[model samples]
Target: MRTAYSVETVRAAERELMDRLPDGALMRRAAAGLAATAVRMLGWVYGARVLLLVGGGDNGGDALLAGALLARRGAAVTAVLLSPDRAHPGGLAALRAAGGSAGPAAAVSGRALVADLVLDGITGIGGSGGLRPEAAELLARLEARRPGAAEPAVLAVDLPSGVDADTGEVPGAAVRATATATFGAYKPGLLVDPGRQRAGTVRLVDIGLGPHLPPQPDLLALQHSDVARLLPLPSPESDKYRRGVVGVAAGSARYPGAAVLAVGGALRGGAGAVRYAGHAAEGVVAAHPETLVSGGAPREAGRVQSWVVGPGLGTGAEAERAVAQVLEADVPVLVDADGLRFLDPGQVRARRAPTLLTPHAGEAAALLDVAREAVESERLVSVRELARRYGATVLLKGSTTLVASGGRPVRVNPTGTGWLATAGSGDVLSGLAGSLLAAGLDALDAASVGAYLHGLAARLAPEPCTAVEVAAALPSAWQQVRATAGTD
Candidate 1:
């Protein structure tokens, strides 16, 4: 799993490493990594003009040492000191000793000042708010010099200046970086939004701080290896019944494709058998000949290890009845799409079996009785709150899909692409998750593994693929998972 540490955790880890290492050793390692990345970004270091925006902290120390390395490699490096007197003394001396020059922050203007790259070291984890007025003015002036002339590639040190390192919030103006060279471990801000958007491509530079980290990370994303271990694999002695069956109640005459997509996903998700009970039975049978069509109510649909309800299910009495029946079942239930609209947290909390709720930002907002923007603003807190309110697993779908169960650490699915946002996507997701649930995975693991596979499948599919294409790509995603399991 790809784990993210909070700012406080990173600081503690750094302290442990610093106690054993010589003075300035960690900074040198971080700076060397940064310099190597800069060389690769600029193609050739010789004669390349580089600009460093220096601040008053260790962040500036990183940039100054990197400038020293670049100068030794024949690059024309200059540091624009925003706080000259308070700058890292050792770093400034190193740069000067290596033939790099320093200039007033206000001097960054005109064609003569254009640079091949700009390193933002204005702030670090200690930064609380936006850029200072002087820093902002200097950036504006530098930006104005280029006037959309393919502005100098920006590389943020640790994080983009002005972004909250812990919350990913851009309280005010923040620099946009083409890449970010971070020290220690990945920060929560680097994976979350505002900061995520600012951080284009992230590169982690190890400063030997991993030994001090806690076993449970603050945030985590399931990788292929984690999914492989968690996914249910049928044994040679297992029968069809032992493998598990998933029952789905989804779609209406108005939205028949939803049923087909959901069943399609279940079939590829390792379910031994799939039972369909809904108004769109014909559509399910026609689209997937293997699906067992049930003409009775969901509660009467023989037996199933897990149930997937909602997904294009229309509102009103009929949809409500189906939801109630799923809740009454002894098996785990995955509620999604339209089913979310009729759900009551009180009823969900009373259920004995595990429940997983998959909702987009809008549906999540409705469940919480808040604006859509409110849930989007703080997704980590929002998903956790939903899980606590219903006593179930809640998966909030978006750019960084978050999955949280009652009092558990939130798992973010990092494999998804924007292309997965097509029609009937959530229906496929719910079916896949329900199949995992039937295979004996817990609610949280089922939701996270299902999301990880669904996203990887989307990315593995050919570009411009439809929902059907995503379902077809599941086997490849599963194969990739198994391939990585041994290594992990």
Candidate 2:
């Protein structure tokens, strides 16, 4: 798992570490790591062009010292001091003593710092909001002056300039780095969207702050091994009844394929049996012969460990009846697709069993009575709010899928791909998650693990395939996750 720490938590940890170490020791360690990465990115340090966009405080110190190191290695390093007077004294002195050029942004020749790399140390974790006018102007000139279509690679020190290290929000202009080398631990902004876009590739460089940091994290991203631990595996004595049965109430005459895809995903989700009760029984049976189909609502579907409601079942009277029946089942229930439209918040809030609501941004916005853009931009806030309001776990699906339940840190899914975006794909996810619910996982676990597998399967499947192909790929993804657990 990848854990992210808040800025306040990071600052407290850094202070503790600094108290035990000698003065200037921490900066040197950070500088060395940054310089080593820059060296690798440049390939050969000799005769390379290394430009440092230096600014105030420790971030500037790290960049300036790194520039000095590159200069000593025969690289022609130039430092464009954004804050000429406020630049780190020791760092600038070292750069000058090492035969590197240090001056205001105007003095730096941008006739194309042509080629190697540009280091952004304009701001660190402490800075907030947008970039200063002077800094922004200098960066614009630098970008415009780059030699025709072959601009130098930009590496940000810590996080990219102008990104909120804690909230992952970018209020204004921000630096877009080719890669960001963050020290100590990962920050929340580096893992989530707008900020995620600007961060590009993120590399964590340890500065020995692990021991001083808190055990819990602000955010968590699961790896293959983590997913493997959560997956259900059968024993020698296991039977169809023992593994657990998933009840799906979905599809209608108008859109029978929804039932087919839902059943397909559930079968691949390791459910012992999939009992599908809906108006599209024939279509489901034709697609997945193994499914046990019934032409009735969930109330008459006999016994089931968990229920998956919605997914192509239109917002009609019959669909409402099925949704109400599933809600009264006294077992975990997953709400998705058209079911989310007529969902009763009071009923969900009153349920003693776990309930998971899977909503795309548009659906979530309708639930909250807000704009879709609001939910998309502030996904973490929206998901948590929905979970609180409905008294259920909520999975807000988008570029960064977030799973949140009351009083728990949101689990940011790291495995999603653009290819997963297609018609009927969401229906498949609903069934897969419902199966996990029946398999005895909690609402949060089921949703997160289901999303992980759903995304991994999409990436593994052949491009431009239908939702059926993505669902079929689940077994292999599950096996691959389990098979690679030992390595992790």
Candidate 3:
């Protein structure tokens, strides 16, 4: 698993490590790593043109010192200091000694701005809101250069400038780095989007802060091995009923396709059996004859370990009654799509069994009573808030999917492509997660693993594939994840 720490926690750990080391040792370690990455990016460093966008503080120092190292290796390096007076004295001296030149941004030559590589040392984790006007203008100028071969590879010092390190929010113009060399630990901003999209390829450089950091993390991303260990594989004695049953209450007369897709997802979600109830039973049975179908509401659908409610069920009186009845069941339940519209927060909060809510940005905004734009921008905050408000786990689906529960570190889904934005994807995810819940995984694990597999399934399918193809790819995705852990 990959863990990300908050700025406050990272700072405390850095302070402790710095105290134990010699003066400037921490900076030296960071500089060495940054320089190494630059070396790999440049291939042959000799005769390479390197431009450093130096500012004040340790961020600029890392760039300057790294440039100094490159200069000594026969690269032509120039530092364009944004804060001339506040530049790191030691770094500037080192660069000059190593044959690197430094000057104010105004004095910078056009050739320098269009160098082969541009190191953006403008701001690191401490910055918030956006970039200053002067810096933004300078970046704009760099961006305006001719496309294709003339474009420079921009490498950010710690993180991309003008992005919130804690929240992943890009309030204004931010640097779009070709790659980012982040030190010590991964920040929440680097894993979540808007900031995530801005930070191109991120490389974490360990400065030995692990021992000093806290055990708890602000965010976590499950790797293949982690998911493999959590998978509920059956034993030799296991039978269909023993594995667990997942009940799905979905679809309407107007939209029966939703039920078919949901059932398809549940059938592939490693569940022993799937019991489907409500209006679309005939459609579901036609699509997947193996499914146990009932024509009545969820209450009459026989016993199930967990229930998935509200995909394609219209927001009418019948849908409301179905949702209410499912919520009344004394079993883990997943609420999604149309079910979310008819949700009673009080009823959800009062449920004895675990409840997981999957909502896209628009749905989350409606639930939170905020603008859709607000939820998209502040996904981390919005997901956490929604979970706390309803006292249920939430999976906020977007470019970067997030799963959050109270007092737990938010889990970010890392395996997804832009192609996942297609219709019915969320419905498939709802059924998959509900199946995991029935298999005895807790709400958090179910939501996280379900999303992990769902995204991976999309990636495994061919390009431009529909949501049905994504569902068809689940078994392959599951096998791949298990293979990573050397399991069958």
Candidate 4:
């Protein structure tokens, strides 16, 4: 698992490490790593033209020192200081000592400076509310790509400039790095969206802060091995009932295909049996003949280990009654799509069994009584808030899917492609997670693993594939994860 610490936590860790190390040792280590990455990106550092955007903070110090290292290696490096007076004295001296050039931000305006790589050290983890106007203009002039000319690979020091390290929020104009060399540890901003999209390829540079950091992180991103360990495997004595059955209450007369897709997802989600009860039973049975189908509310369905409610279920009184009845079930329940519309915080809070709510940005906005834009901009905050409000695990689906539960690090799904934005994707995810719940995984693991597999399935399926094809690719994805853990 890849863990991310908040800025406060990271700062504490950095402070602890700095106390033990000699003066200037940590900065030197960071500069070496940054210089190494720059060397790799430039292919050959000897003749490379490197540009450094320097600010006043330690972030700029790291860039200046790194520029000095590159200069000693025969590269032509220039440090353009945004804060000329406040530049790191030690770093500026080192750059000049190594025969590198240094000048003010104004030096970049009219010059058609051609560089192989640009290092953005204008701001670091503490920066917020976007770049300063002068710095932003300098960055714009340097980064503007000419017609048919190759763009310089921009490398950000530590956290990208103008991003909220704790929240991953890009308040205003921020540097879009082609790659980021994050020192010490991964920040939440590098993994969550808006900030995540701006961050290209991310490489972690170990400055030995692991032992000083907290045992618990603010965020967790599961890897293949972690997912493999969580996946339930059948024993020799296991039977269909022992493996668990998932009950799906979804679809409506107006949209029966939702039920079919949900059932398909459930069938492939490692559950031994799938019992579906809703208005679209006939259509579900037609699509998946093995499904145990019945025309009734979820309560009338046979006992199930878990229940998935609300995909295409409408917002009318009938749908409301169905959602309410499913919530009344003793088993773990996953509420999604139309089901989320009828959610009563009081009822959800009062539930004895675990409840998982999967809502896209729009649905989450409606639930939170905020604009969809608000939820999208603050997904980490939104997911955590939703979980706290309803006392249920909330999965906020988007470019970066997040699963948040109380007192646990929010899980950011690392596996996914933009192609997952297709219709019925969430419905399939709801069923898959519900099945995992039935198979004895907790709400958090279920949602995270379900999303991981769902996204991987989409990638495995042909491009622009329908939701049905994504469902069909689940087994392959499951096998691949298992294989990664040597379980296959």
TM of each candidate vs. truth: 0.94, 0.96, 0.98, 0.98
Count clashes in each candidate, considering only residues at least 3 apart in sequence or on different chains. Answer: 0, 0, 0, 0
lDDT of 3 by residue, 213-280 (tens): 89999999999998998889999999988888999999999889889899898888878999999889
Which one wins by TM-score: 1 or 4?
4
Model 1, range 160-226, lDDT digits (tens) per residue? 9988887677777788899999987888778877578899899888877788888888888777677
Q: What would the per-residue lDDT of candidate 2 be over residues 1-488, giving only the tens digit for each residue?
A: 98899899999999999999999899988898899889877788999988899988789999999999989999898888888989999999999988898888767665535547999999998889979898888777767853365678899999999998986778878899998989999998888876888998888889999999888888888889889999988899999988899999999999899999999889987779999999999988888999988997788777899999999989989898888888988999999989998887898999999999999999999999999988877777788899999999998898888898888777888886888889999999999999999888899999999999999999889997679989999988898899997786
Q: What's model 2's lDDT at 214? A: 88
Candidate 2 overall lDDT versus native? 0.89
TM-score, model 1 to reference = 0.94
lDDT of each: 0.88, 0.89, 0.92, 0.92
lDDT of 4 by residue, 1-488 (tens): 89999999999999999999999999999999999989888899888889999999999999999999999999999889999999999999999999999999876644436788999999989887899999878777766767777788899998789888988888888999999999989999999999998879998999999999999999989988999999988899999989999999999999898999999999988789999999998899889999998898788889899999999999899999999999999889999999999998999999999999999999999999999999999999999999999999999999999999998999999988988889898888888999999999999999999999999999999998789989999999999998876532
Colliding residue pairs in candidate 1:
none
Model 3 misplaced stretches (Cα beyond 4 Å): 147-149, 486-488
TM-score, structure 3 vs. true: 0.98
Worst 10 residues of 2 by lDDT: 106-115
Using lDDT as the yardstick, the better of models 1 and 4 is: 4
Model 4 CA deviation exceeding 4 Å by range: 109-112, 486-488
Q: What is the lDDT of candidate 1?
A: 0.88
Candidates 2 and 4 compared by lDDT, better number: 4
